[model samples]
Target: MKGEHILPLSQSGSARNTHIEDHLDGSSAAIKVIVFGGLDGILTMFAVVSGCAGAAISPLQTICVTLGTLLASAFSMAYGEFISCKAERDYVESERLREEREVEEKPEMEKKEMLDIYTNRYKFSSADAHDLVELTFRNKDFFLRHMMAEELGILLTEDDMTPVKKGLVMFGSFCILGSFPLIGFIGNFLGESGSDTSRIIGFTTTALFSVIGAMSLGYFKGSYMRQRRMISALMMALNGVVVGFISYLSGLVLMTLFPEASI
Candidate 1:
């Protein structure tokens, strides 16, 4: 009797499952920027609000300060991402063009260099290295790809997400996510009289939300659970202090300048 054939379990799944898994594994650059950038904004704003509340400032003033900070931070983050990506792309392209020109002008030298690189990596004999180098040089694209990968540490064919798109996604996510804690503060303040109890409740609520946001970001970024959680907490706390200081100072100034104005 003929031996029975068997298929591997891993190979038996539907192609759709494979496709879905591959897609999921592909990291979205936009999502990454949003997650990190949003965390930064939320942490900063939360710190500001906490500080203002600690100083016994009005909820309205705290809200104003948080909003201003959020807008400024988001814009700055977006612009920075754009410029950085643009610079990277420009550098990579310039290097690639220069390499291509070198290949045309000094084919034999470039071939020898490629041989040396591969020989050093694989510990191949000089004759075998020469043969491999000749084979690679016969295909310009493949030779260039190898050079780029080894020398420059860049993929020749992978599509980079547009910097503008990344910037917009980051800014939008930051504005929306960072606004949650502030919204909680506003809601609490508007619902109750401006008393110490109301202020405490508002601040506590804001912190709680900030913690949740940070934890979520950490998990999404594949960070170590304990470290990420603590880092997130500290960042948010620091933000609270900065924002609070600014709001308190503004309130003090306004109070001094117009004593009649209820700050």
Candidate 2:
């Protein structure tokens, strides 16, 4: 029994599902990767950049801090996202194995459950329910897949997106999207001879990039669900505002605590 239960699920890992982009919800993972990654990168770098500037730290030190943030945050977000998505996938796979066991042990009960679902939730007539259920029953693979989807809302993975891939997606997008805010600072650092104007450019440029990314995400998510677009944009922008406030406040505190230290 245990061996049978484990076999199907174990094999599913190797099974190819379908295209990820076939469904509207397909881009959810990527959106999260981009939005959150961009927002976090912008806000954090903005704060550090501000704090370093406030402390009157040299441009070299500021770059060091900003660059360090880019690397550290990207790695952290990638690892964390990988773990999160993988955990959910693992849970669903485990449940699938359990369901397979139940279906094998009690085929009649499983069939009846499907019949009930179709008739009650889907409003399928009795005749249709019987035919549908019977069709699923004759094929163990289809039966398991149907049961998992209809009853559990757990569809087979639509794509071969592994945790590693998801992580890389996040890491790559995050580094790129998040780098927007740092662009001005970097540009000034490279173009100007270390001056107050360069510092001004750094913060201002960071703000502009952060705003663009945050607002774009807001609009995308809002419109994605056919929701009130304005509300969605405002809400997403609010997240950036909160993060920025906190970052700025932290920088302020840092500057306050060490008036003499050039950190």
What C-alpha lDDT do the candidate models reach, one value each? 0.70, 0.73
| Model 1 TM-score relative to the real fold | 0.74
Clashes of 1: 8
Q: Model 2, 122-226: lDDT tens per residue?
A: 999999999999987898988997788777666564544567887898788778867766787787778776677767776677667676767776787777666
Span of ten consecutive residues with least summed lDDT in model 1: 1-10
lDDT of 2 at 117: 97
| Candidate 1: stretches off by over 4 Å | 1-27, 223-263
**Residue 28, candidate 1: how far off, in angstroms?**
3.0
Per-candidate TM-score against the hidden true structure: 0.74, 0.71
Error of 2 at 171 (Å): 0.8
